[model samples]
Target: VFTLRLIHIFAIHKQLGPKIIIVERMMKDVFFFLFFLSVWLVAYGVTTQALLHPHDGRLEWIFRRVLYRPYLQIFGQIPLDEIDEARVNCSLHPLLLDSSASCPNLYANW
Candidate 1:
């Protein structure tokens, strides 16, 4: 067919050949970077879950706590003010806290 021969002509074009090769190499590099990123993400998720919500029971909430929260934190959604307030509240009344606080049991100066 005429369309098939036209496609073959463009496939063997001299000017576009190098661009196609570059795109292929770029795709490989991108895949490698994605693999590396995923490994770090999983590690962060697991550590955060262990340190923050060790007794969590629900499956959906566990996923959100581990993966979703850390991913958003990476983009600057950290709750520094809340953490400071919680630390203050914990210091003032360490045994009178409710269920809505987020005080990690890591270190005193954390």
Candidate 2:
């Protein structure tokens, strides 16, 4: 396997052994942080879904709103108008007026 070959190469190079060990440790730390981030995401996502789309029945849409949206928003793809009730003009904006996309609720903005 590729991993076996990589281990063989790391084993053959004495100098690389320490570096590989450090990399493995760093990978473990990265996994830990990823796990932590996932927990927080799920917690926040579920709570936000309950507050913003309590009656959402579509599994796919619910998943998108909960996980995908939050992940993208974290990296600055935030929907400012969608999250703020006052800013959203659902009637004028065709996109916001779409059945799939509703205006933000007062509770969600708060």
Candidate 3:
């Protein structure tokens, strides 16, 4: 998004000098659309991966190593009740806190 925005702003700034207002508005809308689309794609990808490989160990390995593990490290595994909610927002508190090091607690509910 940043790269594309930079290109649009710099590469075509002069070309759209007369109608830069309209271009900027359109670019903002496009940026927001792509951001939401990417988010939806990621959600769909993860859901599809889980559904397609329900019993596959590779899926677990990939999810843990690629996503959950780092998440645990950043959040610090601790029980939900034991979590310091004051330090984190309610939405993020659960992700940031889990009792198990591998984040089974986190994935269990997800």
Cα lDDT tens digits, model 1, 1-110, are 99666655666889876676677689999999989987888788878777754544457756776778777887889746435644443322335333344344444222
**Pairs clashing in candidate 2?**
none
Clashing pairs in 3: 77-98, 78-98
What is the alpha-carbon RMSD of candidate 2 to the true structure?
3.9
Please, what are the lDDT tens digits per residue for candidate 2 over residues 24-75?
A: 8999999999999999888888888778766555577678878987788678
Error of 2 at 44 (Å): 0.8
lDDT for each residue of candidate 3 in 1-110, tens digit (9 for 90 to 100): 99677656765567655476677689899999989865765565466445433433444454644445334534566335424334423222334334322222223333
Error in Å for residue 43 of model 1: 0.7
Q: Give the TM-scores of the predictions, in the order they appear.
A: 0.64, 0.76, 0.37
lDDT of each: 0.64, 0.73, 0.49
Report residue 12 deviation for candidate 3 (angstroms).
15
